[model samples]
Target: MSETSPAQRRPSGELEASVLAALWAADGPLSPAEVQSALGGRLARTTVTTILTRLHDKGAASRSRAGRGFAYSPIQDSAGLTARRMRSELDKQDDRNTALARFVSQLTSEDEQLLRTLLDAADDTPQRPGTGPQAAP
Candidate 1:
């Protein structure tokens, strides 16, 4: 049996990112077919649909019934997506404080200073309505 070449396959995360980018570029929500076309038709419609479905399950995207199929829209920008991933990873740890301390230790001096400033600002700011965690739908 012949093995599939890496070039012939996309990393799942990369495909998700591409789909998210297409959604972000679109002025309105896009169907899987539209997403596939926006991605230069490199991916199959089913593949695009599956990626969009996964993103929706992860709360990274939202979908609503449009005609016969669904139209998907990204709930978060790229930076928000990255932050979600980071938070997810941190949540997996039994010792979140230790994990965060290690992560902070790995950051550059500038990043550390920025983190300090952000933390200070966060301490002063009041939690705005609908800005923190929301109840699951």
Candidate 2:
């Protein structure tokens, strides 16, 4: 059998990221065929469908029935996606304190300051609706 060309081979992680990017770029939910088209038609409809399904399972995307197929949309913006990725990685560590300490040690001074300010602001924020005690009807 002939070997796959470099252009024909992409890491599964990269393909998943590309699929998510396509969904995020769309103004509304897109069927797998639309997602394939958005990615320049390089991927098959089945592949796009599988990727979208996996993303939906991972909470990165949501899907709703459309015609005989399903339309997919990103559940979060890019920043939210990045945060989810970071949290997922952090969750994998058995030594979370050590991991966090090492991560903090690598931060740039500016980033360190920004993180401190953000944490401070978060501490001052009121509990969001439905999270705190609810008023009696």
Candidate 3:
């Protein structure tokens, strides 16, 4: 079996993610059929609607009345969705040690070193009063 499941392999529900990305990239909400067509015939309008409904249930999409149909848009952008997905994955693994071990084992040498450096830098830096960096004065 592949280490990554299909759920993880794909960015999100293939049709759902694509439709949400399209809506996010667009100026406004899109109808289900419009989203299906935007995906280049890979999925049906009904499937798109199902995906949209699922996203709505998950709080990742919001639907607004548009004529007889509903227009849908993403609640979060691509990066936000990705972070949520990663967090979901990590959350599923209850053991902190196991999670860390899995993450470390997955990283390449360069990435591991980069993580080490970043962790070390964070440890060395002291937090100041304000959120932004201290003034040069």
Candidate 4:
């Protein structure tokens, strides 16, 4: 068999993840060429474009006219995206309460304290209409 190319050997979604990291690090929207450059040119310009288009389609990114092509920006910053991913995984659980209990049980003391502090602060904060964690679904 022919030797597998590094590109072919790359794990599924790795390229898209790298592309998303580049987008997240960027101060503003980036074109495919810029994204490719940001990734140290490991990916082809076409590949970056494909990832950006996929992100846009999935609502993880937004794009706008930048000359003949589009410039893309992540819809959420890194923290928001991480939280969204956590929520997505949590939503997939058949035993959500058990999953949450296990998750909380594994937290380090500091992390648990921080979570509590955040929760306390959130509770103390006034909620605006249709906003905040306390808002009705």
Off by over 4 Å in 2: 1-8, 128-137
Candidate 1 residue spans exceeding 4 A from truth: 1-8, 127-137
Mark the 10 consecutive residues where model 3 has the least summed lDDT: 128-137
Clashing pairs in 4: none
By summed lDDT, the worst window of 10 consecutive residues in model 2 runs over: 128-137
Q: How far is 59's C-alpha from truth in model 4 (Å)?
A: 2.1
* Model 3, span 73-128: residue lDDT tens: 88888889887977888888879788989889999999999989988898688877
Ranking by TM-score: 1, 2, 4, 3
Model 4 misplaced stretches (Cα beyond 4 Å): 1-8, 130-137
Instruction: Write down the TM-score of every candidate.
Output: 0.85, 0.83, 0.64, 0.79
Model 1, residue pairs in steric clash: none
By lDDT, the best candidate is 1
TM-score of 2: 0.83
Report lDDT (CA) for all predictions: 0.91, 0.90, 0.81, 0.89
Tens digit per residue, CA lDDT, model 1, 1-137 = 32347777656588898999999999999999999999999877888999999999999999999999999999989999899999999999999999999999999999999999999898778777766444234
Clashes (backbone N, CA, C under 3 Å), per candidate, total 0, 0, 0, 0
Cα displacement (angstroms), candidate 2, residue 103, comes to 0.9
